[model samples]
Target: MRSFFKIQFLFLILIFISARLYSQEAENEKPFEAPYLFGSDTLIELSITTNIKELIRDTGKKSKYHQARLSYQLGDSVVSMLVQLKTRGHYRKNKNVCAFPPLRIKFDKASSSYTLFHDQDKLKIVGHCRNNNSRFQQMIFQEYLIYKAYQILTPEGFSVRLARITYKDSAKEVKNLEEYVFFIEDFEKMAKRNGKIPIYKDRIHQNNTMIYEVTRMAVFQFMVGNTDWGVPTLHNIKMIAKTPTSRPVPVPYDFDWASLVNAPYAVPNEKLDIESIHERLYRGYRRTPEELEFVFKEFRMKKESFYSLYQNSDLLTEKEIKRVINYFDEFYDIINNPKLVKRYFIDNSRQVRYK
Candidate 1:
């Protein structure tokens, strides 16, 4: 009886150790916990320290990355990480054109785990063009607002987080420079989130696109008074599809030329034959009245939410807000009037499909 009791006690001790070992192994195999950076619309503040002069001037070469230190607040702690940044854009990358060009930041994904940027790899940072120009800064914020407005319209839109950035230049006397900028969500991240894959083929016709998405994109572009995009060229737009045979869904970005931002350098496409960027044009293909009205109703339903995006913000001046609201009012008027809607959307719409 004593031997049997001793064996039972030893077996129970072994089971206890095995259970603990198994629990620890399971814990080690747990998936990474990622924090959602764009989960809210609240303003974010960030700091980036680097050689500012070299970064701004390094655009002359084909591709060069400058080491930068990025820091941001998370709860009571400030998290800092090493990042590689380089100038990104076609015209804006030119130093003569834009004093401060936009940046593409690459984060160390392995080290970024369990932080605000856990799953983040590369993110585009839209910065104010001219360093000291306040109007340009406002335009940057305006572009951010445009992204926010798009978010209100559809879940397919790219998520953006506006940030007040303080750039610390290590090489110059101007040690600190504050500016308004925003970070665009990674394209692959967004595509995966929507259970889709990004496609890179250009010259595709709009007729090959998802009708509802393409139609909404057209109306939204018209509302923003922007004609700097097209599906044929994939200019200022991205394509994503659920499957190989699925119609590509259009995702628009780069709103710096959008009338809502109205950057000083922005001009209407000469081919568009428009006097100014503010002049609205519907570049989308013609859709049935039923299809158009369905999209129109969606815009009507979300009008107030769109208005509130600018109204509730403290970034834009009273004058700026009023100007934007007035611009929106004009769009609403055009969409509401049957004659204007028919003329702009139905009658004047594109007839020839892209080859």
Candidate 2:
């Protein structure tokens, strides 16, 4: 009896060692790659400036504050852009009222630029001034405000807008600075220009002032290039100001196409299954335990939804989709283990329930 017990104990120890080794190997393996969504062909140019204390001081009281200037040249089409000043505020107070630092921005088509104003007190540009060069100060303030406002209004899709501005202090000395602008056109526009139907449009108002809160998504059959068809791509991405003035100002970071373009596209391969899983599960309004189980089980069996999710989903690219499929085919055995299922349920049950 003692001999038989010792043999059984040895067998159990070997099984434990093998399981640990397999788990470690799985952890060290490379992750699966997703498809590459082709970017727009157009290139964008951008310039930025911040920290304009002197300009601010001089124009603080003026009715019109010049923000920034935007110039774009696309295939021989050139237009000078401007943004009308709306309001401004200091950073310490009125965090909710306006973009902190008492600044509000509005688009002015007449001037073809955007405008900036101090506080949301009125629909006009205003600035403040202290000692020296009041006239030059006002001029600079106006021009800078126009330029800043323009930067705020231009959409990222028409990627060729070039911007430039200067920031000065009370002594008219240059302070902190940043300059460069990059535009990333929305995915829908790119598809449209490439002969695909656009998936999104801005909500238009009769007054011409855009109601930024609402957007309409297109639902129709559209051809996008030769590879993929019948799906909507990402849309309405705009280039937002990273730094408002010569000094750093918090501006909402929107879709940045420039960065996306520079990054290398991932190649297709079997290592992309995790991403496939994430993309498949991310869709739909609410998912339950049974639904989650169905996805995992079906995916392990070369299911269509598992592949279709990545292929039809506008969020990923063709190359990425193939990679995810490959990963699923190769690693299904490891991925579908019973232990993984139990652990996944325990950790993600609350999230699934809430969704």
Candidate 3:
């Protein structure tokens, strides 16, 4: 009897160990929906039926989400689901500036299975600001490419999937609206993919940020001629870290104002002292010469890939492509030359420390 009881005890222990190991494996597995949604480079075709006029007129009361129907094609079938959407973002949400504001989409997780949106809860959508204007559409495409460029620079960045969407108003008589839009990956999903926790507080200083990552972010912003982001204020940037005690990494977004995109509405901040967005400014924290060199080398290694983004595109016109490449040529010239690097990067870098 004693031996039998001892065997039972060992059996229970074995079962417990197996359960724990299985749980760990499940935790480590990749999210089931991301691969289907973001794995392919091809643009996704999607349709949304909602009250378009009402959505755009929202006045930031943090009002209720407007009901909508989202549909996309898969193989031989069309998948449709009920979704909740609302106008999001400050500048884009302004009716005077943008006819169509950016959107925040919430999905029904229980019913989101077996489709591209499987296991997805919420996702941000960036669309063209103005309707009936091809120039605005082209600007959006350029912004999407900027997101792609950052993704190439770091795995710790957000992943964006471009889509061509047709907006249909159910209640109004407006014509069908077609535009190029892109879906930004969920924040929690990005942090989990990078094995980090998303930091919500904006008080963390750049000195506490990871040296190599922050330096890379700063240099990339300078290359793109963006002076719009700040780490401490969390202005147009997101933060993440391995743990609460670990140094954070800045993830930048919203580049419609970057000189690379050159949207008409984009202008330099009055306090920045720059006359125009065309002028480049280095806003990153000061780094050691060795650290700056290390970050510069990474950009140098990826130069060809960056150029190929514009050279091998089917979206932009040849004229626009040439213009963009020429703009970046100036950036490459500065990074490659020692004297120019010091003038723009070292001497022009931000001297104030954000506490």
Candidate 4:
């Protein structure tokens, strides 16, 4: 009787331990909830105490986030809140074009995503700056459309919210400008939506990356005629891993300098052997025929929906639409032709990802 009782007690202890571990696992694997953030046309008003020019030109300084007040009139009520701002982007900073420098905004401790301001530790805001040039403004708008295209392709991507921001210079009355700007989905939030955690490991090989995600990314990059990204450099790319042991997936961004947008300042890398941003190059590794066939079939399925996106774009002018569509047409033409795909994407595929 003593031996039987002792065995029963051990079994009960094992059951208790198993239950505790299962509870923890269930919490971690809970279904991801997505926040339906952003409006089609949200009018935002902002007031900053810092000198707008100095704050924007503070490219080298990264010590502190400048404080500011943000307010938007909701019906009859004024929703005013405290916020912090920081300068963003590298190329635009060096180009002396004050018109389009990107920025990062953070909500005050008092503010939460549920509050009128929405929840975010920091939000990536791509500004429409640079002498208030209409062309540049058009370019910014087109880039936002690109983000939308990615979203349609996969739910596991960044979503952009358009905001017409009005800035007031605290020191200089005439230094303010009302321009079209857009903010992107926060990275932490994106990971949650995908039921995964963000992986910051850079310079990882494409082979080590998720096949579906990397192939889609590579095909999409080709469609955009962009040669600016690579797996090793982590340039214009982000990765997320489902778990520590899961293979990472690639998420690409920063389309302002890509071929399809073709901003005046955008240039192709000389090492790419292309003189124009309009040139398309296959930068992804050459996979087996079976692997590439699957990817190509995916793109073929996405072709009509992809073109439809550009056709109904909200911000692109007729001419801008034509130019972008034509560029895509070139890519589709290549992918449609077996001979061309072999010569361009497969035959021309880089054997080495780094080189």
Cα lDDT, model 3, residue 104 = 89
Tens-digit lDDT track of model 4 for 60-106? 64625777777766678766777887887777766465544678888
- For model 3, the run of ten residues with the poorest summed lDDT: 30-39
| Best by the lDDT measure | 1
lDDT of 3 by residue, 1-355 (tens): 9999999999999999999999999998956534467677788999999998887787485846899999989889988998999988887777788888888899987667777888789899988999978888888888888888888798888888999999999997778999999998888889999999999989777767887888899888888878888888999889999998788998988888988787888889999968999888888776666778888899889999999998898888887799788878988898788888788778877675549
> What's model 2's TM-score?
0.27
Scored against the true structure, residue 286 in model 3 reaches a CA lDDT of: 64
Error of 3 at 172 (Å): 4.3
Model 2 misplaced regions, further than 4 Å: 1-41, 48-66, 73-78, 84-105, 111-172, 175-290, 293-338, 351-355
lDDT of 1 at 351: 91
Model 2 scores a C-alpha lDDT of: 0.31
Order of the predicted models by TM-score, top scorer first:
1, 3, 4, 2
Each model's RMSD to truth, in Å? 3.7, 27.1, 6.3, 8.7
- State which candidate has the highest TM-score: 1
State residue 335's C-alpha deviation in candidate 2, in Å: 6.4
The alpha-carbon lDDT assigned to residue 102 of candidate 1 equals: 87
Is 3 or 4 the stronger prediction by TM-score?
A: 3
Over 49-164, each residue of candidate 2 has an lDDT whose tens digit, in order, gives 32344334332344345464434454566545454332343321232322112233344545532212111122212222222433323322222222222232322223222222
Model 3's number of clashes is: 0
